[model samples]
Target: MKNQTSITSVLLMSLSDDQETISVLFIFFLLIYLMTVFSNFLIILLVVTCAHLHTPMYFFLGNLAFLDMSCSSVTAPSMLSHLITQHWSMSLSECIIQMFFVIYFAGSEAFLLSSMSYDRYVAICRPLHYSQLMSWGTCAEMASLVWSTPFLLTITYTICLRRLTFCGPNLIQNFFCDLPHLFQISCTDPTINVFILIIVGGTVGIAAFVITFYPYVRIFRAVLRIGTSDGKSKAFSTCTSHLTVVTIFYVSATFIYLVPDTSNLLTLNCVFSVIYTLITPLLNPLIYSLRSKDLKAALSKALHIHRLHPDTATRR
Candidate 1:
């Protein structure tokens, strides 16, 4: 790549520089990426085709599946390609665009998780009013808010980052063009960028965390109030999958962002980045669909329908 800007391009660090390790890691990540796409797509297919899953819960879940695929796409494919060639290079513009989407989808996922939590809270805590509370319009509005706000905010920071000139070593010590990694290579002061990340991005993270978990606090209380063991069991079952997902996502996110890394090192950040960017997306659909009898039934039904008429999809 030719130098197009103050710095023409940046070199991204591979997960491993060793050829043998790169080969092994390439295969491992390829399998993981493929599995993540397939699993999330399965959830989407089941949600779209199954009439029984058209409720608010599954609607949010379908959106999540789409986001998971997108988030994984942002980094996994690029990382895989770089691993194979052992050459991780991207032009300045490409790096900025990649970072934008990474943050965009990540922030959107955070808000979407919170939205799903609210849906669960309504369904379990106020069962009588779930329909009234989570009507089609309400859900649509929430979805729109979660998706759009993140894009705008991410754009703001990306543009801020773009304005910063890069005149130093163009090597980024991470698999992808993460904001922090980008900050490390900038010639201009990144104090404002850091401020936005901490104040704006941190605020978003905290808000997402509070929204996502606060509902569970009430949910737990309501679950305990149930008199029958079966009722309590049923209530807990409804939210456990979501709770598991939330815990994984938030813990990874908090470790990455909220708690400052005193060392400002890239090694630890890379590990956590892989968790949320790749592992969380890979696990989200499983968490939602694994223990779900309805999802299983839907999947079975879809397969059965496909077996009955292989050409049905083509006709549609």
Candidate 2:
């Protein structure tokens, strides 16, 4: 029988047991991590340096890109290291730390996207007040709220979660040590923890989604009523990028939460996690640039900055 005392929450901080799988997966994840980082960094750079992207919409997109970059960075690199090394242990402290950032970044991204959607709605529906209403102060306050609120709540949840004793098997069935996965492996009943997760999570995380989307329902009605064909087209196009991101994140997240945690579904869980965490960041830059002509222009200017001093740029 396995020794009850000899167990840990993190299985693979360094090369895990699955050597062949780890080798292949490590390369794949490394490529994705670099892409996510580069793409998000470029998006943020374009938003900040380019005059055309100084609007509130791109402002929010910039933050989303930042959050996505952070979310992927917090988990993916360490995870890749675990897949390739002999040491596969994340102490309780480390695990909780990872969990905190992951949840915070994830939560912040969600809230920001919802806020962005509301910004789009205001711009398209209430053009007169769009600028005045979504001024620098308002934007900063919203951004602060998004960041600080999620950070505090997730820290509390993670603290409570880490206190649970791990007398059972330590082998985490999935790639990363998620809340549900950890609770599932515990020796005692995780009723209270799971209950808290659903209540706190469903209320805060899911509530943000509801608040964001419900307004869109009304905004779409207004979009349809626009007198000019061009007006309708523009309004719909403005929402396209936000909708794509929201759909991608919410769908994958729902699946991860809705599907009863089961060994049979472990593979599916990992795949869906990749969809939201790894894949979403790459899509954000491409989607924004392609869908919005303004972002494309900003990107052009950003690229042009180097062209202006191509010789000097190369020297440095």
Candidate 3:
């Protein structure tokens, strides 16, 4: 294939080609996007407004809610627009920007999940030192690290991606601009890019996974030693929601990133991408609200207060 320096855009593949099917999908995804944003926003709002929820756990949860909303927003609007207009082409710059945020938010979320797990471990395994270990200052530092570290890594990844030549076919096989898809289509050899992805990305992912789940081992041991059934139940309840969210996020992400990208697996990759990008955000709020009694109680109290003092709520 001859190199074309003027290749400035790429075509994104839509899930369906039929206009009728596209319309149905557009409506379905639009609803999911709206619900995802609203629900996650509500979680953030609840965490911010509820004084009783101003603990380390809720602090990390609020950050997760924000990340979920931001992460979903990175792709949902673009995908919805493509579905509605049946326009699957995006400028190279736009695609690169989207890819940058995708990596940034995803990496940040993995680290944030690890932070949350540490918070739980402290609460369960080191209850006597929970306050000191998970101080507001310490939590702030961890949150800063989670958000900032990924920006650097994503910048490095994007710089490497920018150096690659995309002079050949510019049709991306999936709905969004992901690294693997981009690497696959590069006219130039992507051996360096692949190495960075595997070395840097893999190290971060593995470390985050270890940080996020390894605590559960100690947590389980601690819970087992609790004398009362109620004690064990309460301890497990605190972890169940975070664990569920972590499992879903890591499982989907691992499948998409770790598995070899072959022609036969492109469709499967897209499906898993949808799960991580769209479905996970929608499920996060549901999982937290349904499994977390504190969040439910906080929502109830907020609603009751709103009903009683509509004027006050409006003014605020």
TM-score leader: 3
The lDDT for every candidate, in the order shown, is 0.88, 0.79, 0.91
Per-residue alpha-carbon lDDT of model 2 for 1-316, expressed as tens digits? 2355735545632333577877888898899899889988988988887877888888898899889898888878777766766466677557667767777888898889888987987887788998899999999999999889898888778777755767656666655666776676676677888788888887997789887798789788998898999988877888888898888888988888788767688677778877877888788877887898887777676568779989888998
| Segments of candidate 3 deviating more than 4 angstroms | 1-3
What range of 10 consecutive residues in model 2 has the weakest lDDT sum? 6-15
Which regions in candidate 2 have their CA more than 4 angstroms from the true location?
1-6, 12-22, 86-88, 314-316
Q: Is candidate 1 or candidate 3 better by TM-score?
A: 3
lDDT per residue for candidate 1 within 8-37, as digits (tens), equals 799987677688888888888899999999
TM-scores for every candidate against the unseen true structure: 0.93, 0.91, 0.96
Query: Which pairs of residues clash in candidate 3, taking residues 3 or more apart in a chain or in different chains?
Result: none
> Candidate 1, after superposition: displacement of residue 93 in Å?
1.2
lDDT of 2: 0.79
> Which candidate has the top score in lDDT?
3
lDDT of 3 by residue, 1-316 (tens): 4545747999998799788888888889999999999999999999998899999999998999999999999999999988878889999889889999998999999999999999999999998998999999999999999999999999999989867888748889888898887887788889999999889988988999999999999999999999999999999999999999999999999888888777899889889999999999999999999998899999999899889999998898
